[model samples]
Target: MSSSAPNAVLSVSGIGKTYAQPVLSNIDLTLLRGEVLALTGENGAGKSTLSKIIGGLVTPTTGQMLFNGRAYTPGSRTQAEELGIRMVMQELNLLPTLSVAENLFLDNLPSHGGWISRKQLRSAAIEAMAQVGLDAIDPDTLVGELGIGHQQMVEIARNLIGDCHVLILDEPTAMLTAREVEMLFDQISRLQARGVAIIYISHRLEELARVAQRIAVLRDGNLVCVEPMANYNSEQLVNLMVGRELGEHMDMGVRTIGAPALTVKGLSRADKVLDVSFEVRAGEIFGISGLIGAGRTELLRLIYGADIADSGTVALGSPAKVADIRSPVDAVRHGIALITEDRKGEGLLLTQSISANIALGNMPAISSAGLVNGRDESALAQRQIDAMRIRSSSPDQLVCELSGGNQQKVVIGRWLERDCAVLLFDEPTRGIDVGAKFDIYALLGELTRQGKALVVVSSDLRELMLICDRIGVLSAGRLIETFERDSWTQDELLAAAFAGYQKRDALLHEAAPRNTL
Candidate 1:
């Protein structure tokens, strides 16, 4: 009765997709029950498109798919879910306005006599949250109140609630903390024990070796390789993912450092950024590293005047201290630009044309007598498209149609067109591919070479170590320490990042009296 390959849980053959061009072509892959397949590729290499086809989000141009040795073509997400197939997409689908308990069991909330059972919901939520190390969070708390990393965990927990045989996790740990990642790994192990087939998509090479039994490398819409994880070392995996050898890090040659380009002092925000202070030198890259909810993003928001700081002083340029940045306009006028962390919300206008979006932050430059020059805007967009190497059919294309990486490039391209003296990048490479990431790195180096100061915030510790001349650690809203490139080690950085939370726990124990300290 089975039409699929023997013992295969899911099978895809001759799958192809075309957009402005052929994004994916003649693809074939199979998933086996109780096995983990690590799916990896550069951005826009058709990994997400292929995942979308399997998840019933996007119809493939041409392909045949089978699940459990039977013809399986899901018409919609609901159909796939009904067939015991689920996907945790990179862009979360949860309603942020709802409570954790509500979002987790939204599809099948407990009800009796036409009344919702809050008591049962709390119990179920606690159990599910505990699985992902979110036990301490209140179930009734709104998901909007959670940070990005916490929200990611909530998304994963929601997926695990139902009967699932095949699950596709796209960039599952991209925003997770170290501890949260460990909890996720544990959950994956349990799922494997229960005979679940998992297709794990991630950019972190080390994580694949830990969770995936087999690795499948996709490049340029083709199945480049599928081999045992042990068969491919980290370097070899990178080679396959990008179809070339990539160095561990790019070396930015030595340069003369100028006076401080931007200086921040006494930066404080209620319960988010506390007494943060730092100075970024001209032609140098400074990095900030910390755990999720450790105030890294909040600190950048404060400096850029996106969020009001309770107490702070921001001075731009060497020896010429200027007015405080009370608004984003003030920050911009002072030659400060912030590439925000949320590309979907803060960084882009997805519904607008790519040319229009790029003209957003550069209106003053692109406009003539208060009216934007259409020809100039198109030319500007075209210049950036070439410089950023964005893959797009035309400047008239909507931003939403492009991949995440291309959209990010548009954001950076906007600032590059400006004459900003200091650039603040928040999680700049969050979901960028290795190739695109290196390009951004080279761009950063080029920016610094032009004497522009750069402040970069990233969750990847290795990335911070490699790119920044100096790095600062933010732990629980406090700037714990800063270290030169030669001084910072992974262990030391992690220790500094986790120090605040450890001290807070110790203080609570001492105050509790039962656990006297």
Candidate 2:
């Protein structure tokens, strides 16, 4: 559709953004009232850049925007919000120290005579929280106490509070549960009924097909296609996004399976993880699949010594001798590495250069007598840059400058420099695109070929089935069942994931007293 179309609620002409180099170029797009538009592309394809431009997070270098056929130039996010435009970015923006209610209505708190009205705030917060399936959480509770998934919901609820004519959601479901995703979709439907335009960005092809009315695929900072969602299938959409045909199956390189490399026995950490026991053999990939709040991450944290296990033993090697791992340093000494889900927060030092970040754990190799060797650090970072095919200008470039996929590569490169016996990956391909996901899968294959034991935790069941030799299902803080690669089906795995919760709910119902008239 053209920018002058009557139904267009917002339109951009010749939109582009640049930082050190051109990222977005000559983008012309229109958002119609009461319609969902899907924006998709590979990592570093400038989708986020364009959205930021529209949402006033970033100013366009060369473009003009029109809202309802009038000139619209927002200098800041607050200006955009005042103009009824909102964006929910992938990286959450919330005050962890403040209560959920405060964070939700911080800009426009309900007050009387310059004093905050707790009653009014709580009532309004409850109404908003219920729409996003967060009614169980107390509004007075600090946002820091909630999990990442709930924080994402609160961010969404905050944007949904005031008037919003155009809403942009960037990977909104990346940290959300299946039920929460449905609730968000229901809210989206309600907003659509109110004539609110939406721009939905995600890597999941199925969700795009379900929620988007029109699909726009960007590649290499260019707009390639804009068509109705029904015009293309998932495969076609992926092909358009990546500019190549990708197969559904993967060819994992052959490797010899050896004795157990890492074993956990009776691992329990409060109610988050309960008596979890598993073994990952050398050259084997053990996958963990579970719904949100099922304690998948907690189990990984305990194994990596990031969290203490109340009662458990972590044994290493074939003879299986228990290792005394109390902290991350000890875990590293014992040859265990964890690639955290919060890569930005835990994995990399964004303000530092690529060489500096890679030199973190490999200080011994890059330093001499309490001094870092510049040449050695550059060489180390360059090796991984070439090996992982990380697209960066130079080793001196800051980690914050790279895209999501490239940043993840930097994290993996740091661990690859070490001879770790076991590797734990939490949502390795969480926010990456389809092509980048395959890159990670291939890396896992290479790691296994090198006799490294790998444990992967993913929210996507299909991902586990694709790369895992054996998959373990976590349900309600317990390991429900483990399924072999070929022996498991989607339906069976999902059923097993919910089994523990079902049993717990049944017992709770049976224990409750019933009243009769």
Candidate 3:
């Protein structure tokens, strides 16, 4: 295959995909060298399906895919890799037991006549790691030992090891820190300089505006629009993706906040969580912000009884009661709900239907006299889907088939349906794109307005700054400081979160009893 023109690395015309039903129809897309094309859509909006078709992970049920003006049909991932097309999926695909260098050089190890060249493999892995700005990670380090951000870098290095012409990244920054995200953008720019056609898929519209040359939107299994990034603002992009104006109506209206709904005093969890104390008032958005591994997630798990806290007191004001909740079921019965950080692992039954996942939270409410009430369950699921504006083919569709944003919504809907008063959300908007993020934020506001106290734990400083009224900063498993919305800046919050631990210790000492000292 050869190209007459200098541009147009890959082209797709009338690309249609179908499984049990139509997943995409008449989708047209073009990837040009030195340019980034962002694919945006809501959950189950056919973005992943389209990407799969391009990467040869899945063949389109209809339409044609062309590379450099030649008919291109990929029978397997190997074929695509050979053709200079590589895709990094949302879910990582690294062998955890393997060393980082081994994983990077798995496909193309330097060899000497049936013998592997260890030195060559290590050198090549180092070069690839450097390309992605991950120089600190030793090639000999185990893949499982690295954080999610480092794992992502390894995936990128794997793609770069190939003669990649078209690079596709799906939700790559979902688990990254601010510094890591900047590094990724720098590497992406370098790739663009090398004339590699990049297809970037993310829920964050702001990122697309910064890095992407153009943006394409998909809805209901159809290509809705494709235009320059400059042509669309955040609001316009969201409207196009969702096919409706997302308004402030999702706000949980203003309500009178009562006494503290939940109070955690002297919470500790081994090395991950130190003595942490905080209070979430009814109808308030109490947010927890810190860098990754700052103990925010462990603290949430302790509150929800997912992980045991060495010692802590949780007091609920509703009926003015306090009790020891040592398990998830106990927390649920006590009007508490937890939306975990790892949605795929903890929040969803990927193989089950949306209805099943939604109904799983409160089974007794949907059941009747030792018999499951199918009609009532269906009705309840339908109501949540409508309320949350979850985009799905049907309530019966498997959750695994939906996009990242939609999956998050399903998890949230599960808790919302149970009418939980104290909701703890961990990275609630982690993998969700920008437009969907706004919807979730609005939904959080609505929850607070309804007198439901929310404690949101997030790595996104901007997200915490925008949605939370009061933010708590944690470091080394300890609560270092607290900031009101007006008093906190991004830099200040970051500093307090990472460097204020000593100050917190001093404060704790001053507050302790003289007899104990």
Candidate 4:
């Protein structure tokens, strides 16, 4: 499809981008009105670059874009939006300090005589929030206080506010719950009905088949395939994305299970995390499965001392001696490491070079007498880059310039330098690609082989099943149940995840007074 096509809402020809080197090249694609186009590829394959070009976040080195048959050149995101072209990027574009209502209507505030109309803003925000299943949340609540999943929904809602001719969603459901994802799909259907052109970008192949009418696959900066989505299966799509057939079964290698290396007893933190307790053995990967508000991330934060536990004890080693962990520094000193879910916000210093980011925590080895050893710092980063297969020009490349999956690799690479006995990974592969996910899985297996206990929290139950020795389900801030790999089923895990919430709801119902007329 080209710009000349009658129904084409947007089209790009000879689209290419280069930064230090060519990241995208010679891409020709068209978006039809009221049709969903699925754009997918491995990380660094130029999916984001192409979307950014179309969305006006980045300028293409060589190319031309046509919007409804007219030449379109967007110099800034504001310019693009003004022309009814909007995008919800993978990296959130939100003001943390602002209230949800304020962020949603920041560009076009409802005002009268230079005064903001609080009533109008709240009403509009509530209507938008309800579309994404955020009706229960107060519009005046600060965005920073909401979980990553909620924040992602807020970003989506903001884009859907005004007249939107073209909407590009880049990994929109990465942090969303299954229910939240359903809500998003429902909204997508409504948008389709309204004749909105959508470019849905995601690594989740199943999602592409579900939502997109046509599929466009990119590989190594080149457009490889553009066909009806039904023509290819998930496995076939994966093969196209990575340029190789990936086996269904993973090779975790041989490893021996050992004694309990990390133990949490009676962990509680107000209503968010309630009396959560578990033990992770050396040479074992303990997986945490839960819904978005089920307190999975909060539990991990408590264990890592990112947040203090109101009442709990964290212990390390065979005999289970309690460790006093009040902060991240204390946790690190005690040989505990946490790979946070919000990689951009919490994990990496985006402006810094890859070498500098990797050398952040491992300064002791890379520095001498307060003077940093440049050779040692570079070597430390180079070792992990090679190990993690991080795609970059060199160690000096800034983390912000790298792709999302590659940036995640740098975050993992930083922790690999430390010989932490217990590692906690919170949505480690949240926005990563399939091939890179396997790489991290292999790394986890290696850690287990080294007798390091690993705790992985993931929204994907299949992911937990694939890499975990035992899976523990968190429900309404409680550890509902823990099942061995062979003993657990998907349905069983999901039931356990909702068990706490169900019980709580039942109790609340019984406590409420009933009026009889």
Candidate 5:
């Protein structure tokens, strides 16, 4: 739908936010009615700050926000909602104890005078859920009973039911399946038809190309560029976002495959992970690529012992059989490390200092007689920080204060300190910028040069193609296929990832039982 008609739906002019230091400066953005504007940048590039300003979660230190060509400043979330603006954050905000229906129309529950109208509320909730392609979830079902993907859908449904004219989604597809992402795109198309201006933010540049008409780039608290999607490719978009050419195909010669460092046999995790098996060779860069919910992350979690496996045997070099690693500590002791996908929630201690977080995994090295050697710790932390090129005010600064890229580096530094022989990185570059991504790739290469085995799980096929020696593809909790780096193109990888290896054969097999019956 073309939004070339007169008044813009939302206009942000000279928007500047200054915390203790400048967060965003002299920014200008416009969202036309029915247009999807993708806001993208490196983590800590002030994109979230800008979104908060629009959603009224934060008041700009300077400048103004105009809605319908009228000066508008929402003092609170309720005010923003009242003004037909709503934000669906990356982190879900649903009450687990409440039913799906209750979470859907939480703000304006249907009521007759002073009494509640439960029946009307459920009907409305169903309608809203239908809009987001989530009709399977019962309205009365407790939110806690739903999966993460379902809960995400509930959040999106809630915004739609609010009759929001302006919708802001921050990293909405970060954890959604391919089918779920398609469902969301369909909903966005419908919302656009109704003249709802959307501010879409995500680390996945490819999705932005598909859904957004215009793209805005932010870098270091400044609006660097804004242009139509027709004018840019993935490479150009990344270049603009990071202000540098992220070198094509990082050097991987440093890591040469040797004997197996770790091996998994018949790994099973109920329905999500089924008879999965893989091996990581020392000094090799192994990658796992799959659509969300394909069991890649789950398999990694099982191997790391973050989650229990009903059946599996893990061998960690030297004829040692690890029966069952019940916890992360056991995995660590076996020289295995897993960098979690949710860096904020699982990987880093945001409130702690960078030095403390970086040194946390290798505390024994700095401890003598149960006393930490402060000087030794500082030196070790500083060495890793310099090597990783972590951009921070100081090692003493809280990790929460660093950019997403820097924080990720801190996490990597922690694992590096442990001198782990095997490392599993899940979405290691999800929220980081292009420049930092290159740095991480280089670090991975360096680690492998030192004979450390690495396994990377990523949603971006291009990343896997560029950095990994071999790639494994998963679909529906099954290990569908594997490919050497030279064996497949990005298009082929994506095809296998989305369509699976034997679609026709699988369908034929499923139909065989029915045909015989």
Candidate 6:
């Protein structure tokens, strides 16, 4: 007796999971040969858990799966790899100590006797890297030397190596440039032609619509919808994922922009940032957009005093004057708060309780005569949490257990609890779902309403366009142009984003001279 579904490469039935709480329940999905199925939902919605289970990284508490029309349960990631299942996790899996060649062929290094074949390694590495459009990177380069985007490419290349029946890519384009993303889509097409089953998970909804043939939406551990990607518009898909009606577009709300609240003049740091000057007004949402490595983050770090500037002035206030921001402590003393891109590293104390993490930043305010006021601290946490709408069981819950979006909210909430007059956000909505992103945008709106100045740096061009009153495009560490909300178009902004990367001086020098705050 043979199964009727001959083309089904993977079939999951009654799949469920639990970890200190019920995460997933009664989920079913199918991956046919040569088709791209997208799984999307808010963070902690069990999408990652499902993909992890399929990749043998986590054990499902309840479920049965059939692979190639047979009962399949992999004991480990290695076992899954042996069975031709691969997962490219959002957090990169490459070893920094190893060379790109070594990381690519870590499990099965080519060797004769006991001696590794460097020649053969480079040859094989180049081919695989080229497959993923990484032809420029030398095979012998250390993985640590590469930037985040290039590292992501290496991870993808590693997964595409040998015997890949099923490939699961989690937020694959999160760090990639627009050009690299197109390259990835091309590779996906090539793989599909060879009958590979691909599962793509991304927070960027538009990418899913473009690349996936079918979409499976999961929300709060339950499968909400599964259908051809063609059937659902962006709004419908977002509605299914977050269980709410949301417009796919954002309009500039009426907000009064006032005197300069934060100002940087001639900001320069080695070659990472150069002669950058800008002013962000009170109640103004100023956005900075650029390609990766274009000095946006470096510039923010300089203003926040996370990094030192060679020669520049940073100021904060309604009537701004140069403030000596020699360190983050100095910056904080002048009412400046920076929500870093690396949330897990610089933003949150993950192992601590949510209340404690939020309370950590404002100890002086929460303390009475140096003795901790437990009640005031808890109240403070609850206040910001409510305002931010951070989803958590209670303030007592550990920050580590919450989703990416919630963790981000906690970081922002901590800063919000302070008396900061200026907030600088770097990739503020990175790893956040569409619904949560809107929530953040709304939160930003509220902050501006309170007359707190904001400087946001983002890789997402449209996100900046949606939220910012003014948008500045940085090129090769230079503030090439800054455009007012009424003065910019999407195509113009996109052209400016790639200005530094366009391989010509004409593009590098283009744009309106600059905009006054």
TM-score: which candidate is best?
A: 4
Which scores better on lDDT, 3 or 6?
6
Task: Write candidate 4's Cα lDDT for 1-517 as tens digits.
Answer: 6578888999999999988899998999999999999998898888888988888889999989999889999999999999999999989989999999999999999999999999999999999899888988899999999999999999999999989999999999999878889999999999999999999999887888999999999998999999998898888889977888887688888989899999999999989999988999999999999999999999989988999999989999989999999999999999999998898789999999999999997989889899999999999999999998998999999999999889989998898868899999998888788888898899989989999999999988888999999999999999999999899999999899889999999998898887643
Candidates in order, TM-scores: namely 0.95, 0.96, 0.85, 0.98, 0.88, 0.90
Task: Name the regions of candidate 1 deviating beyond 4 angstroms.
Answer: 1-5, 320-322, 511-517
RMSD in order of candidates: 2.2, 1.7, 5.5, 1.2, 3.7, 5.1
Of candidate 5, the 10-residue stretch with the lowest lDDT total is 1-10
lDDT of 2 by residue, 1-517 (tens): 8987888999998998888888888998999999999999988788778888889989999989999889999999999999999999877889989999999999999999999999999999998899898888899999977767788899999999989999999989887767788999999999999999999999999899999999998887889888999999888888988899999988887978899999999999998999899999999999999888899888998988999999999999999989999998899999999998777668989999999999997999989899999999999999988887777889999998887778888988898868899999988888788887888899899999999999999888888899999999999999999999799999999999899999889988898877632
**Candidate 3's residue-wise lDDT over 1-517, tens digit each?**
1234469889898889878778899887777888999988877687778888899899888888788778999998889999999998887789889999999988877899979888888888889898877876789999977755678779878988868899998888887776678888998998999999999988776788899999988888888788898998878887887787775333345567777888888899897888898888998889897766678877888888888888877878754466689998899888899998667657899999999999999688899887778888788888888877777878888998887678889998887756788999988887775556776787888787778899998878878887787999888687889998689888889887767566667888999897974
Worst 10 residues of 1 by lDDT: 1-10
* Candidate 2 local lDDT, residue 23: 88
Better TM-score candidate (1, 5)? 1
Kindly list the per-residue Cα lDDT of model 1 for residues 327-443, writing each as its tens digit. 899888888999987777688999999899999989987898899999999999999888878878899999988876788898888898688999999988877888778888888
- Score candidate 5 by lDDT: 0.83
lDDT of each: 0.88, 0.90, 0.83, 0.92, 0.83, 0.87
Question: What is candidate 1's TM-score against the reference?
Answer: 0.95
What candidate 6 gets wrong by more than 4 Å, as runs, is 1-4, 97-99, 115-123, 138-145, 249-253, 369-371, 503-517
CA error at residue 375 for candidate 4, angstroms:
1.1
lDDT of 3 at 14: 85
444: Cα error in model 4, Å:
0.5
Instruction: Kindly indicate the candidate among 1 and 4 with the higher TM-score.
Output: 4
Global fold similarity of model 3 (TM-score): 0.85
lDDT of 2: 0.90
Backbone steric clashes in candidate 6, count: 0
